[model samples]
Target: MSTSRMPLALRALRTLLWILAVFGAVGLALGLVGLAVMTEEEVVRETGVGRSASMAALLPGFALVLVEAYLAATLIRGGRARRWCVRVLAVLTLLSGLLGLLFLDVAGLFEVAVAVLLLALHESRSAREWYRSGTETGKPDGAVPAPTG
Candidate 1:
Protein backbone atom coordinates (compact mmCIF):
# COMPACT_ATOMS: atom_id res chain seq x y z
CA MET A 1 0.00 0.00 0.00
CA SER A 2 1.07 3.56 -0.73
CA THR A 3 -0.07 7.07 0.03
CA SER A 4 -0.84 9.44 -2.77
CA ARG A 5 0.02 12.40 -0.61
CA MET A 6 2.20 12.87 2.43
CA PRO A 7 0.08 12.66 5.56
CA LEU A 8 -0.48 16.00 7.24
CA ALA A 9 1.23 14.89 10.43
CA LEU A 10 4.31 13.67 8.56
CA ARG A 11 4.49 16.92 6.63
CA ALA A 12 4.27 18.94 9.81
CA LEU A 13 6.92 16.79 11.50
CA ARG A 14 9.27 17.24 8.55
CA THR A 15 8.79 20.98 8.63
CA LEU A 16 9.47 21.09 12.35
CA LEU A 17 12.61 19.04 11.89
CA TRP A 18 13.81 21.42 9.19
CA ILE A 19 13.13 24.37 11.45
CA LEU A 20 15.12 22.67 14.20
CA ALA A 21 18.00 22.17 11.75
CA VAL A 22 18.00 25.86 10.91
CA PHE A 23 17.83 26.73 14.59
CA GLY A 24 20.80 24.48 15.33
CA ALA A 25 22.80 25.96 12.47
CA VAL A 26 22.12 29.50 13.64
CA GLY A 27 23.06 28.57 17.19
CA LEU A 28 26.29 26.96 16.01
CA ALA A 29 27.22 30.04 13.97
CA LEU A 30 26.45 32.38 16.85
CA GLY A 31 28.41 30.22 19.27
CA LEU A 32 31.43 30.23 16.96
CA VAL A 33 31.22 34.01 16.60
CA GLY A 34 30.95 34.47 20.35
CA LEU A 35 33.93 32.25 20.95
CA ALA A 36 35.97 34.02 18.30
CA VAL A 37 35.21 37.44 19.78
CA MET A 38 35.77 36.58 23.41
CA THR A 39 39.08 37.52 24.93
CA GLU A 40 41.24 34.81 26.51
CA GLU A 41 40.82 36.53 29.88
CA GLU A 42 37.05 36.54 29.51
CA VAL A 43 36.99 32.84 28.58
CA VAL A 44 39.16 31.96 31.56
CA ARG A 45 37.11 34.10 33.92
CA GLU A 46 33.78 32.73 32.70
CA THR A 47 34.75 29.06 32.66
CA GLY A 48 37.53 29.10 35.25
CA VAL A 49 39.52 27.29 32.60
CA GLY A 50 42.49 28.16 30.44
CA ARG A 51 41.85 29.34 26.87
CA SER A 52 42.38 25.85 25.47
CA ALA A 53 40.16 24.25 28.10
CA SER A 54 37.39 26.76 27.52
CA MET A 55 37.49 26.03 23.79
CA ALA A 56 37.41 22.32 24.52
CA ALA A 57 34.39 22.83 26.79
CA LEU A 58 32.47 24.07 23.77
CA LEU A 59 32.93 20.75 21.99
CA PRO A 60 29.74 19.11 23.37
CA GLY A 61 27.58 22.00 22.21
CA PHE A 62 29.18 21.89 18.78
CA ALA A 63 28.58 18.14 18.63
CA LEU A 64 24.93 18.53 19.58
CA VAL A 65 24.41 21.10 16.84
CA LEU A 66 26.11 18.86 14.31
CA VAL A 67 23.87 15.95 15.32
CA GLU A 68 20.79 18.13 15.02
CA ALA A 69 21.81 19.18 11.54
CA TYR A 70 22.42 15.57 10.55
CA LEU A 71 19.07 14.50 12.01
CA ALA A 72 17.27 17.13 9.96
CA ALA A 73 18.99 16.01 6.78
CA THR A 74 18.20 12.32 7.39
CA LEU A 75 14.58 13.09 8.19
CA ILE A 76 14.22 15.15 5.07
CA ARG A 77 15.79 12.46 2.90
CA GLY A 78 13.99 9.53 4.59
CA GLY A 79 15.71 6.11 4.84
CA ARG A 80 16.58 3.26 7.22
CA ALA A 81 19.37 5.36 8.67
CA ARG A 82 16.83 8.01 9.56
CA ARG A 83 14.88 5.49 11.64
CA TRP A 84 17.90 4.71 13.79
CA CYS A 85 18.98 8.34 14.03
CA VAL A 86 15.54 9.42 15.13
CA ARG A 87 15.53 6.73 17.81
CA VAL A 88 18.91 7.82 19.10
CA LEU A 89 17.97 11.48 19.04
CA ALA A 90 14.73 10.80 20.84
CA VAL A 91 16.55 8.93 23.58
CA LEU A 92 19.11 11.70 23.97
CA THR A 93 16.43 14.34 24.07
CA LEU A 94 14.48 12.42 26.66
CA LEU A 95 17.52 11.95 28.86
CA SER A 96 18.54 15.58 28.57
CA GLY A 97 15.02 16.74 29.28
CA LEU A 98 14.76 14.54 32.33
CA LEU A 99 18.07 15.80 33.64
CA GLY A 100 16.94 19.37 33.06
CA LEU A 101 13.70 18.79 34.92
CA LEU A 102 15.56 17.22 37.80
CA PHE A 103 17.61 20.39 38.04
CA LEU A 104 14.46 22.56 37.90
CA ASP A 105 15.24 24.01 34.52
CA VAL A 106 12.27 25.21 32.45
CA ALA A 107 14.16 24.63 29.23
CA GLY A 108 14.62 20.98 30.18
CA LEU A 109 10.90 20.57 30.69
CA PHE A 110 10.31 22.09 27.26
CA GLU A 111 12.85 19.72 25.81
CA VAL A 112 11.05 16.83 27.41
CA ALA A 113 7.84 17.89 25.75
CA VAL A 114 9.55 18.14 22.42
CA ALA A 115 11.11 14.74 22.91
CA VAL A 116 7.74 13.21 23.62
CA LEU A 117 6.32 14.75 20.50
CA LEU A 118 9.20 13.50 18.43
CA LEU A 119 8.75 10.02 19.78
CA ALA A 120 5.04 10.13 19.08
CA LEU A 121 5.65 11.24 15.54
CA HIS A 122 8.18 8.54 14.98
CA GLU A 123 6.00 5.81 16.39
CA SER A 124 2.84 6.77 14.59
CA ARG A 125 1.40 3.97 12.45
CA SER A 126 1.74 5.92 9.26
CA ALA A 127 5.30 6.87 10.02
CA ARG A 128 6.24 3.29 10.86
CA GLU A 129 4.67 1.94 7.69
CA TRP A 130 6.24 4.66 5.65
CA TYR A 131 9.68 3.96 7.03
CA ARG A 132 9.36 0.23 6.59
CA SER A 133 8.33 0.48 2.96
CA GLY A 134 10.21 3.63 1.98
CA THR A 135 13.55 2.42 3.28
CA GLU A 136 13.21 -0.91 1.53
CA THR A 137 12.65 0.84 -1.80
CA GLY A 138 14.82 3.93 -1.12
CA LYS A 139 11.76 6.01 -1.99
CA PRO A 140 9.10 7.60 0.15
CA ASP A 141 5.67 6.00 0.35
CA GLY A 142 4.12 9.33 -0.56
CA ALA A 143 5.71 9.57 -3.96
CA VAL A 144 3.36 10.91 -6.62
CA PRO A 145 1.90 8.05 -8.57
CA ALA A 146 2.33 7.88 -12.32
CA PRO A 147 -0.95 8.54 -14.05
CA THR A 148 -2.31 5.59 -16.01
CA GLY A 149 -4.60 5.73 -19.01
Candidate 2:
Protein backbone atom coordinates (compact mmCIF):
# COMPACT_ATOMS: atom_id res chain seq x y z
CA MET A 1 0.00 0.00 0.00
CA SER A 2 3.00 2.26 0.38
CA THR A 3 3.51 4.57 -2.55
CA SER A 4 7.22 3.88 -2.66
CA ARG A 5 6.82 0.12 -2.94
CA MET A 6 4.09 0.08 -5.55
CA PRO A 7 4.57 -2.14 -8.59
CA LEU A 8 3.52 -1.03 -12.05
CA ALA A 9 2.15 -4.43 -12.96
CA LEU A 10 -0.28 -4.35 -10.08
CA ARG A 11 -1.67 -1.04 -11.27
CA ALA A 12 -1.88 -2.37 -14.80
CA LEU A 13 -3.71 -5.46 -13.63
CA ARG A 14 -6.21 -3.37 -11.72
CA THR A 15 -6.90 -1.34 -14.83
CA LEU A 16 -7.22 -4.50 -16.88
CA LEU A 17 -9.73 -5.89 -14.42
CA TRP A 18 -11.95 -2.84 -14.88
CA ILE A 19 -11.79 -3.20 -18.63
CA LEU A 20 -12.44 -6.92 -18.39
CA ALA A 21 -15.43 -6.40 -16.14
CA VAL A 22 -17.00 -4.14 -18.75
CA PHE A 23 -16.42 -6.67 -21.51
CA GLY A 24 -17.72 -9.48 -19.36
CA ALA A 25 -20.88 -7.52 -18.77
CA VAL A 26 -21.26 -7.04 -22.49
CA GLY A 27 -20.75 -10.72 -23.12
CA LEU A 28 -23.38 -11.52 -20.53
CA ALA A 29 -25.84 -9.17 -22.20
CA LEU A 30 -25.16 -10.74 -25.57
CA GLY A 31 -25.78 -14.21 -24.19
CA LEU A 32 -29.06 -13.08 -22.69
CA VAL A 33 -30.04 -11.55 -25.98
CA GLY A 34 -29.20 -14.74 -27.81
CA LEU A 35 -31.32 -16.69 -25.37
CA ALA A 36 -34.23 -14.30 -25.76
CA VAL A 37 -34.25 -13.72 -29.50
CA MET A 38 -32.88 -16.85 -31.08
CA THR A 39 -34.27 -20.33 -31.26
CA GLU A 40 -32.07 -23.33 -30.63
CA GLU A 41 -32.28 -24.32 -34.27
CA GLU A 42 -31.44 -20.83 -35.47
CA VAL A 43 -28.49 -20.57 -33.10
CA VAL A 44 -27.07 -23.88 -34.24
CA ARG A 45 -27.54 -23.02 -37.88
CA GLU A 46 -26.13 -19.50 -37.64
CA THR A 47 -23.12 -20.23 -35.45
CA GLY A 48 -22.48 -23.90 -36.27
CA VAL A 49 -22.68 -24.29 -32.52
CA GLY A 50 -25.23 -25.63 -30.11
CA ARG A 51 -27.26 -23.18 -28.11
CA SER A 52 -26.52 -25.03 -24.90
CA ALA A 53 -22.81 -25.03 -25.59
CA SER A 54 -22.76 -21.35 -26.50
CA MET A 55 -24.55 -20.35 -23.35
CA ALA A 56 -22.32 -22.55 -21.26
CA ALA A 57 -19.25 -20.97 -22.77
CA LEU A 58 -20.44 -17.45 -22.10
CA LEU A 59 -21.62 -18.13 -18.56
CA PRO A 60 -18.18 -18.32 -16.99
CA GLY A 61 -17.08 -14.92 -18.20
CA PHE A 62 -20.32 -13.43 -16.96
CA ALA A 63 -19.98 -15.15 -13.63
CA LEU A 64 -16.38 -14.04 -13.35
CA VAL A 65 -17.39 -10.38 -13.52
CA LEU A 66 -19.53 -10.90 -10.47
CA VAL A 67 -16.65 -12.70 -8.85
CA GLU A 68 -14.32 -9.89 -9.74
CA ALA A 69 -16.77 -7.38 -8.28
CA TYR A 70 -16.89 -9.33 -5.07
CA LEU A 71 -13.13 -9.47 -4.98
CA ALA A 72 -12.84 -5.75 -5.53
CA ALA A 73 -15.30 -5.07 -2.76
CA THR A 74 -13.90 -7.51 -0.21
CA LEU A 75 -10.33 -6.67 -1.06
CA ILE A 76 -10.95 -3.16 0.11
CA ARG A 77 -12.61 -4.45 3.29
CA GLY A 78 -9.45 -6.44 4.15
CA GLY A 79 -10.33 -9.64 6.00
CA ARG A 80 -10.86 -13.37 5.49
CA ALA A 81 -13.35 -12.55 2.77
CA ARG A 82 -10.63 -10.83 0.79
CA ARG A 83 -8.35 -13.83 0.95
CA TRP A 84 -11.15 -16.17 -0.05
CA CYS A 85 -12.13 -13.92 -2.95
CA VAL A 86 -8.61 -13.92 -4.40
CA ARG A 87 -8.32 -17.68 -4.11
CA VAL A 88 -11.71 -18.20 -5.68
CA LEU A 89 -10.85 -15.94 -8.63
CA ALA A 90 -7.55 -17.73 -9.15
CA VAL A 91 -9.18 -21.14 -9.15
CA LEU A 92 -12.01 -20.02 -11.39
CA THR A 93 -9.64 -18.54 -13.93
CA LEU A 94 -7.62 -21.73 -14.09
CA LEU A 95 -10.73 -23.84 -14.43
CA SER A 96 -12.11 -21.59 -17.14
CA GLY A 97 -8.88 -21.92 -19.12
CA LEU A 98 -8.95 -25.67 -18.80
CA LEU A 99 -12.56 -25.88 -19.87
CA GLY A 100 -11.91 -23.74 -22.93
CA LEU A 101 -8.94 -25.85 -23.85
CA LEU A 102 -10.99 -29.01 -23.63
CA PHE A 103 -13.55 -27.47 -25.96
CA LEU A 104 -10.85 -26.40 -28.44
CA ASP A 105 -11.81 -22.76 -28.10
CA VAL A 106 -8.62 -20.73 -28.18
CA ALA A 107 -10.36 -17.38 -27.74
CA GLY A 108 -11.93 -18.43 -24.48
CA LEU A 109 -8.72 -20.01 -23.34
CA PHE A 110 -6.78 -16.86 -24.11
CA GLU A 111 -9.16 -14.69 -22.10
CA VAL A 112 -8.81 -16.98 -19.12
CA ALA A 113 -5.06 -17.13 -19.49
CA VAL A 114 -4.79 -13.36 -19.52
CA ALA A 115 -6.89 -13.07 -16.39
CA VAL A 116 -4.98 -15.78 -14.56
CA LEU A 117 -1.58 -14.51 -15.56
CA LEU A 118 -2.30 -10.95 -14.45
CA LEU A 119 -3.71 -12.03 -11.13
CA ALA A 120 -0.94 -14.52 -10.56
CA LEU A 121 1.69 -11.95 -11.30
CA HIS A 122 0.16 -9.45 -8.92
CA GLU A 123 -0.23 -11.98 -6.13
CA SER A 124 3.24 -13.40 -6.53
CA ARG A 125 4.85 -10.02 -6.52
CA SER A 126 2.88 -8.94 -3.49
CA ALA A 127 3.79 -12.16 -1.69
CA ARG A 128 7.43 -11.74 -2.54
CA GLU A 129 7.45 -8.28 -1.03
CA TRP A 130 5.68 -9.56 2.04
CA TYR A 131 8.16 -12.40 2.46
CA ARG A 132 11.14 -10.13 2.08
CA SER A 133 9.87 -7.60 4.59
CA GLY A 134 8.98 -10.28 7.09
CA THR A 135 12.32 -12.03 6.83
CA GLU A 136 14.53 -8.98 6.71
CA THR A 137 12.70 -6.46 8.84
CA GLY A 138 10.71 -8.77 11.12
CA LYS A 139 7.36 -7.27 10.23
CA PRO A 140 4.47 -8.19 7.97
CA ASP A 141 2.38 -5.84 5.91
CA GLY A 142 -1.29 -5.67 6.93
CA ALA A 143 -1.25 -9.17 8.48
CA VAL A 144 -0.93 -9.97 12.16
CA PRO A 145 2.51 -11.25 13.10
CA ALA A 146 2.75 -14.75 14.57
CA PRO A 147 3.81 -14.97 18.24
CA THR A 148 7.44 -15.95 18.59
CA GLY A 149 9.31 -17.23 21.62
Candidate 1 Cα misplacement greater than 4 A, ranges:
1-4, 135-149
Question: Which window of ten consecutive residues has the lowest lDDT sum in model 2?
Answer: 131-140
Estimate the TM-score for candidate 1.
Answer: 0.74
Candidate achieving the largest lDDT: 1
Position 50, candidate 2: lDDT: 83
Q: Write the per-residue lDDT of candidate 2 for residues 1-149, one digit (tens) a residue.
A: 23133245544555666766777798799777977699988988887888888778776666789777655433322334454566667677777778888899887677677757766755776644633342322222345546689
TM-score of each: 0.74, 0.61
Scored against the true structure, residue 68 in model 2 reaches a CA lDDT of 72
Q: What is the C-alpha lDDT of each candidate?
A: 0.71, 0.62
Q: Predicted candidate 2: what Cα RMSD to the true structure?
A: 7.4
Write candidate 1's Cα lDDT for 40-82 as tens digits. Answer: 8887777787767766766776777677666665564566677
